[model samples]
Target: MNYRNLFYALALAITANLGVMAQGHKGPAWLSNAVFYQIYPSSYMDTDGNGIGDLPGITSKLDYIKSIGVNTIWLNPVFESGWFDGGYDIIDFYKIDPRFGTNTDMVNLINEAHKRGIKVCLDLVAGHTSDKCQWFKECASGDRNSRYADYFIWSDSISRKDMEQIRQRNSEPNPQASTRGKWVELDAPRGKYYQKNYYVCQPALNYGYANPNPANPWEQSVNAPGPQAVRRELRNIMAFWFDKGVDGFRVDMAASLVKGDPDKKAVMALWQEMRAWINKNYPECVLVSEWSDPKKSIPAGFNIDFEIHLADKIYNTLFFASDDPWGAKGKECYFDKRGLGSLDYFYKKYADIYTSTHDKGYVAFPTANHDFQRLRTGRRYDLQQLKVAMTFFLTMPGVPFIYYGDEIGMKYLPGLQPKEGSRKRSGTRTPMQWSAGETAGFSTCKPENLYFPVDTENGKISVAAEDNDPRSLLNFVRGLIKLRHSSPALNNDGKWQLVSDHSKPYPMVYTRFVDGETYATALNPSGHSVTASLAHLGKAEKMSLTGKVKYKTGNANDKIELGPVSAAVFKIR
Candidate 1:
């Protein structure tokens, strides 16, 4: 081959070897072993004594977060907001909310985190904004043809036919924003009814519909002047933060953009445009979307799409038996001590996404986020059960997000009165428990002034208490992370295999292998001992074990045993 052609071939080979996107976008190679910690800033740390957590508080905990083995911290929206739907109803993209901290504090936090080899990902509320946003206020008060007028969706009145037509054409399985379909009304001077993305306080920004029905004058095409401008605004917002040294974004309601199109083709195209722009400008910045479907989101150009654990999502099979409070019962989750759960649900979805997107992007998993219950909630709080769950998450493929305070087994405090619209989720978003005290070391302020009351059991599950105990859950998690960082076979793109087992949910066995290196893992969530066959290892000698393994065998008949609610990782020599 000619020199130029040979060079092109070599480049393609190198990209493939590095497990990069086939589309030529250089995804953040750091995400290969990235262990992310999701922080709901308002509840993470309170330094101001005003009971609200701030960017400075986050900066103060950089060492603690780093020591826990998190290389990336995902902070929920820090932008100025109306505070109706948590911090998601963003009013200003460029300025940090006064409740959080100043813009300088954010930059300082980013710099401090990077000094500890940690990347910071801020939540991007891409779809909508606070009704109190200046743009929305102007749009509401101005003429229909005003500059900010087309920034959001506005209509005089919606007939039944129009609502049905719009909903029928917009195709995303279970669309969140459109399901409500409740538009707010205003006086005669302003538009009669305005469209909303979520709560009443938030209005959906106009990205325009992918396919506009000619009969519906309200429906705007994606190429319309307003949409194109909104797209530019989105780009500008990203540029503002990227300039400030922010790492990337976990885009909220990513798939909810670009309405009125079946098959989500137009929304996908919109993100593709974004991907091209970001690739050209900030190639190293990662974009992890809350699309929850990696098969489409990865191909659509996001670096990683979270495989969220929701009722309908694939992750509920494991770690969440029910969504209710402590000891609630329903379908037994894969992490339950009863071992009544099935892996078929999680495995099928996981395998399909992994098979299609492994080389292109990744499917990220979260222990828990601000929206739902935690790993220590319900009847699953036992340290052994948690260790097994952590082992499965840390060693498994894709990025793993440890929601703030999940490392030390923070409880999902139930029945705390709702605030900032957390509702039943208020318990899950409680302050991080650091140590025993009146405020549980979360803040020096009075207990009544806390963002949400610290858990009553904080004395038992606090981080400081666990950090000093060698056998505690905190130490177990640290060990798992250290091993994950040290093992190539357990890295993001390692070839994975499921060891055969007849025990069903008793013992979950899988192996990670690459470049002649291999590591086998077994998780027994059951209440009794279970054995898994390691015959597939092919004369490979057992090297070392990470977690507690009750029994292991080495003869030609290879078998490893697991204790109740325990996990073991075996390094294959």
Candidate 2:
């Protein structure tokens, strides 16, 4: 079919399907085809010459972000923090970090973003707070009767010997150890120990335990006064931001709120309550969780959840493999061009999660985030291979979040010193390269003063250079995002079905159904060309090459021949 004819057919099909599925539950209406761009504020753009990125700096770059065809922006934590955990160790929830800008700057940012039709989502660190926070300080004052004393988990006085025993117990493989040695003893009048969720500087807040143990006085019940007070404070924080024009939040460590509940029922209930409050007060606001389990997080009222970097073998199989220079240890990822990885692991988990949450929420697939390496990292340095990965990411049936520099094929600098508690992840959080000039045009400040050094070795990858090249990864990603926005069959609510066998070595085939039309997509991540038969699945008639990939179709038995590191889409008329 001609391009014009195809457009008209799609429009009619979508109109017809909308009538039939009007009653069916889908995620938020605005998120049907929303493309999200994640920006680490400290690394995105530096305008004040203070060696750090700020809110005004982000506001100045809204035009560039909008040009990439993304409608949503997820900013990493900009709250007042000690910079101990890269802004995750928030010291004040209501204020923006001084390094980033003032609270007024954030308000201005939200205004400018909304003017450009872009929604802003701030990162909410709800699980813990910096040890230097006022609340934690108050709790650590040894005043048992202090109003904020129970805001954090505090245990009775423990001798040095007892603390050592607790540490030993934590070191051993004891699944029955109800209270692990996640505590630190404070030298104060009360002389109590407090629990920490992550680093020693981040103390876990008192959200209460799912199953309280009398032996551990710190394990307060969910209904306890302290837990109730914490819930109220969470609501207040959300309301504060919602009132300031912020559209939503991407909650950090969402699943770790409640302790000692393997089933996570209490944590789920806590979020449900928060969701209820959000719906009633800020109806337009949305909530996305960092929780990797969509089956549990979606039902708990999270509008979306990520499917990246969490102990999931399927996730590692698709992106991180043993041979990957940055990865710990594993087989080759499916897109490594090695033909050694299988999609069964990913497909099975995805199917189960999708089946359970298709009506309620979505599972996001980010190109990469601050906590993980970029798509072009390690052995997968070829831009063509990245195009294939982008094909799968953009065409999948969920929200697609592109990390700031992923569109430009940014490389993860190896062996960089840690910054703001970013140990190995420091490489991925490098400043965005806007040009090939000094400092990659990321900041006008001296190179030594940059928040994080730009990739200067072997010539930096800059946006200006990529903008001039039509075949560059930047332009290719822009094309995929534009296509996703214009096609209902590729939206977040589309139904996904695997057309090729999971055991296939190359040319992975899948069909996305939506608006009464079928969109078949094929990806070949292998080094050589390969043909796959789709006759057993169904007729995929109208074929079209999408992105920067190369492919050919055969009429005999509905087979498709895909070139190395290529991807294509078919209308399936």
Q: Evaluate model 2: give its TM-score.
A: 0.90
Report residue 451 deviation for candidate 1 (angstroms): 0.7
lDDT of 1 by residue, 1-573 (tens): 257645654553444333334335428678787889999999888898988888998899889998898799999999998886789989998899999989999999999988889998999999999977988888888577877878888777688765664466355443433335556555435577777877767888899987688787768977778887888999999999999898899999999888886687778767877876777688778889988888778867788888876424777777667654522356667788777788887777777777888878877788888888888877787777788888888888878889998898888888888777677788888888888987788788998888888763748888877888988888888888898888778877787877755336567888899999988878887887777666746434433333447434566557767767777777766
**Candidate number of the best lDDT:** 2
Clashing pairs for predicted structure model 2, backbone only: 322-330
The pairs that clash in candidate 1 are none
CA-lDDT, candidates in order: 0.79, 0.81
lDDT of 2 by residue, 415-528 (tens): 888887787898899999898766888888999988878874434478888886888888888888877777788888888888787877577888888778878889988787
Task: Determine the C-alpha RMSD for candidate 2 after optimal superposition of all C-alphas.
Answer: 9.6
TM-score of each: 0.90, 0.90
